[model samples]
Target: MAKPTTEVALISVIVALFLVSTTFASSDAPFIVAHKKVSLNRLKSGAEKVSVSIDLYNQGTVTAYDVSLSDDSWTQDVFDLAGGNTSKSWERIDAGSLVSHSFVLESKVKTMFYGAPAVIKFRIPTKAALQEAYSTPMPPLDILADRPPEKKFEWAKMLLTKYGSLVSVISIVVLFVYLVATPSKSSALKGSKKRR
Candidate 1:
């Protein structure tokens, strides 16, 4: 009876290990990651030139199919698409690959607004349903603010304020090391007299 119980326990353990291994092996699905960046420049005609770019990466072992990117964070009344379309589609994104999309937006009105994250949709070969992901959200921005360019003196002042104390501390430490490492004049003269 005891021998039979031991065999049953061993069989169960082997079965559990097999199940765990298969579960890990079947996780070879495609994972999509996205990041969005926006840069604002004041155009000469008093309009805001907002250049937006989205970077997508596939970090899994399998390929993603029917990839679509949509970003409708800004409305037509507030902003206008100056260069590229807001939505894009791709046939496939292989593993360990990167894709990027960029669009230029132009706004004439001065406004402070918050933006939303872009949506990404893709399908895995083994899965029937589409998987959805989002890009990192952006912080609120004050477009067309009266921010003037810094002068040369202002740059110097900024550096001084940021590093003046650190420079002083480092100088003091070097001076202390020099004083400790070098013998004093009086000590050198005394040693010479003793030698004489």
Candidate 2:
């Protein structure tokens, strides 16, 4: 009795987790998915220059911000560097995943990702930050979008996509099975042959 009830409750909780994620619940239903990317491996100190791209999709509006996207590393003295100097020290500029910088304007109501309205864009100023730090190794990026994490956590994304439908289907299946297995009034169905 209690066992079956507990099992059902557990399933219900799992279904709910599969439905809603950290946020961006339905993010415009198919647009508005933030994708914050970065790079580190092939970054040659002075071999070439600061070059990277950080593009976020699925935006509901458009805005801008003076976000620090490129370098997370900085020394105490680096803070005093002029914006222009900071730009040079960073040596790289690319987009990052931080919605905090997004600014909303009355004129900008909607944008799109691929086809949907993009809410905001993170134009990372890598070179700018590099210049600010000047020769110091840029700190690791802390501006990536807090979403679609590792392989295991990523499964949650797929589950949430068709959550409503999946939940309905699962519920229907469970109900159907219970009805078939549970007798109408007793442990056995009427007119059924008993096992000899």
Candidate 3:
């Protein structure tokens, strides 16, 4: 009786762990990641450029399609960010029913650069010209959540800009220690001097 009960419990635990692990597994789960960047030129005129990027993956037994640089408000148009990359792409696209469709973006950028960039919203719908792409619903972002946090990694900036004196003193101390550890030129020459 005890042995059977222990076996059942062990089997249950194994099944539960397998399910949990598979759920979080990278290859098994389908996910998409997007990287967007936008910049604004204070001196430039209202001229703007836009860049877009996309990455799609289908972990299940179906194909993902119709990937687009979709901001219905036409927002990603940034202006005068000289020689900047505005769009991103995936490494490669795999083929198969459960295949993932990754896309690269190169449209406009100035509009998407700021969260308040004319309030452009991005949506991934299930529209397709070749394959039936599934629609992915997007939830509204928290009004304040998108704002940059008041506290930031600003300490590094302070060290770079305002702590120059401290950095210089530390560098001087390090140089002194290095010099003391090294044999002096006079000492090295003394051993070879024949008469002097």
TM-score of each: 0.67, 0.19, 0.26
In terms of lDDT, the poorest run of 10 residues in model 3 is 112-121
Off by over 4 Å in 2: 1-38, 41-154, 184-196
lDDT of each: 0.86, 0.32, 0.38
Give the alpha carbon lDDT tens digit for every residue of 31-111 in model 1. 777888999988999899889999999877789999999999987887988999899999999999999999999999888
> Per lDDT, what order, best first?
1, 3, 2
Q: How would you encode candidate 2's per-residue C-alpha lDDT over 1-196 as one tens digit per residue? A: 5775466557655644553452246332212233223232211231212223333322322222332333322233212222222111112222222332222111111111111111221232222321111111222332212335359666777787859688999999999999998777654544455653
lDDT comparing candidate 1 with the true structure: 0.86
Q: How high is the lDDT of residue 74 in model 2?
A: 27
**CA lDDT, candidate 1, residue 45:** 96
Best by lDDT: 1
Clashes of 1: 0
Error of 3 at 89 (Å): 16
Q: Is candidate 1 or candidate 3 better by lDDT?
A: 1
Among all windows of ten consecutive residues in candidate 2, which has the lowest summed lDDT?
Answer: 104-113
Q: Which residue pairs of candidate 1 clash?
A: none
